[model samples]
Target: MGNQRTTTLEARVSLAQDPATTPATLYELCSDPSPEVRAAVAARPEAPAEALRPLTRDRDRTVREAVARNPSSSQANLLRLVGDADRWVRWAVAANPAVDTRIRQQMVKAQDKELRGLLAEMPDLEPDLAAVLIRDVSPEVRERLAAHTEDLDVITALLADRTVRVRKGLAINQRTTAEHRHALAGDSSPDVRAALVRALELDEADLQALVHDRSVEVRRSLATSAVTPQHIRRALESDPDETVAEDARGYQAAGEPRTAHRRPIGKRFPGRRGR
Candidate 1:
């Protein structure tokens, strides 16, 4: 009896995994006694919608999650899976590259903050979706959008966000424009300015503002950042804040290679030292 069941499982598993397995065969496996066979069929990108749709409600979470993760799963099925009781199933829906825009709009209002945050990081998130996340109640979700979205308008809007954490995410985001960096340089929060110093490059005007910033933390970050233009680090050597000056001296003592002294040259010819 054991051997008979094992043989059936092997044959079904093989049938489920076969690239040439017909849709009719895959559909038949959905009702197979083994959950593994159902899950394998669910995960196949070419699995027909009819075969995957029923698996979305499979008693086994793995089978349902495989359907959620399958790009070939239809929007209607994905939308249903997005609300699955299992956290992994919902997350899989958010991470699916083929997730439809309408589904993302629903995700924006999901009670789960992590699920909403995952949607914020989608590479192709439309501006309308980005706008909703910008207004998300959770700072973490907004912060993730601020850090990753390439939408300039979204970045611009987030610059005015009341939450310092959201602005800090914008500070470090490479996609932020020169104007955005310059605007952040004058931010009221010392932490925001400090985060700005960690950017890949800063406008000369922004760098000058940071050089004289009242916050020791901002100046200190500027001093230690390997990308700080050589001349800017020299200016910090005489900073009124002793800690800032000390960090500048320490950066020099480390023999960090020479970097361009101004944005025009630094922007064109970046320093060799890996930051």
Candidate 2:
């Protein structure tokens, strides 16, 4: 199902474009006659800016896109890219963290949903703009907000959003309050309840609510997770479904040291962060 050799210019371009590519190889690749090869170099953030300088004026949109996405690209390069004929190039420039703050402020208001989606993940995103995106008509945008924004009130409101996607984002977000997790425990979608139980560091109190969820899948998720409290696991050891009960026994044995139910040491297994 995959090519094994790096013999072609196309194959060479793929290798040179990787972030881990050596600088000397990147320099050689930058001078390749193929714009595709050069585009690959432009995408490497670790590539020298001098190599990237020539690509800013490249005729190919793909090359320009790579330069626009490179975090190490200078403000001048980004400002230059912002005026490119392609909208996605400009979108890429707007999403660049190293770009000027003034430019980024304007980008936050871009009408394009996908562009807005990229802006949603920017670490320096304006607080007011963050609020605006949460209410945006795009559930995808709201989902990103749920994944990124640390604001408690925003996460709380998203829990009750009309769309399941937005609700899912909040359902797994660690910032979700115990109160919110309690409310979400009764969500109509088994997916939502199942997601909450799989979180490695959830409030121990959640087990009480989720153990009685309508979906066997939801109950099985709680039953099988080593993070489930021992008392809850003990109850699940006799679940009506034989497979779920078996899984509970397997989990219960692994859960002996998890008495406190605080996050497991050095483990960061979050609930579903994607659809």
Candidate 3:
């Protein structure tokens, strides 16, 4: 093992850049003074459990996070990471599939909403626990769970959630019912309503309602969406907002039929390439 605590930048770069590194070399690099090297080591799927353990308490946040995400990290190392000061590290631990069942149970009731959201993504959470997460205090967790789970009952509740962000997540989910999509059309947030405009299940009536939205941005989304009804797109060609009117004209010029799953257009014009 290299007794040197620190390496030059070149050496550290080699640790990450070199793909052919041996497991023995990776184990030794686990203790490298450069946190990035340690992070790179933790990033390896073949990282040994013994080497991964000590880095769990590494002073650098990235190093700890890397360990939490490493597939080879042992349950004990992951458990320690579960309590890491950084929320993202704990999030990584919760996201790790190999985390112990006991630790997952503890995470189920954790106060941190991000931790709960990541936990909700795991496939094997208890039904009762899943329910608790659906009704979680944090809208982010609610949204995360709605995005991950196929539970219809949960979808129903999430569509009615007080937070627009949560409801928007439900609206964008293809599985959200048409009834739910229509109900969400009345959401106060234009962002939420605009999200509905882009949903695969959006009702024709809902699509029309958005075309007449007070916000030019909302109307722009309609013209931008590949699925905007021909009538609606025609109406937008005469919109007061020049930008929106131009988008309607562009959509018309392209002459593409409204598709149920059209290329998603945002605030920009349909042909306006790049983000």
Top candidate by TM-score: 1
Best by lDDT: 1
Candidate 3 per-residue C-alpha lDDT over 30-128 given as tens digits, one digit per residue, 9 for 90 to 100: 777778788887877877787688789889999999989887888888878888889989988877768877778778788887788887776656777
- The residue-by-residue lDDT of candidate 2 on 97-207, one tens digit each, is 687666665556667677677767666467777778878888898888886767877777677788887777777777677788787877888887787788634566667
Rank by TM-score (best first) = 1, 3, 2
Indicate whether candidate 1 or candidate 2 has the larger lDDT: 1
Expressed as tens digits, the lDDT of each residue in 170-216 for candidate 1 is 98889888888888889999999888896658978888878888888
* TM-score of every prediction relative to native: 0.84, 0.65, 0.67
Query: Candidate 2 regions off by >4 Å?
Result: 1-57, 72-95, 252-275
| Shift in Å, residue 133, candidate 1 | 2.1
Model 2 clash tally, residue pairs: 0
Worst 10 residues of 1 by lDDT: 259-268
Instruction: Give the winner by TM-score: 1 or 3.
Output: 1
Instruction: For model 2, state the Cα shift of residue 148 in Å.
Output: 2.3
Backbone steric clashes in candidate 3, count: 0
Candidate 1 residues lying further than 4 Å off, grouped into runs, are 1-11, 252-275
Q: Candidates' lDDT values, in order? A: 0.87, 0.75, 0.77
Stretches of model 3 off by over 4 angstroms after superposition: 1-40, 94-104, 120-126, 186-191, 208-220, 235-247, 250-275
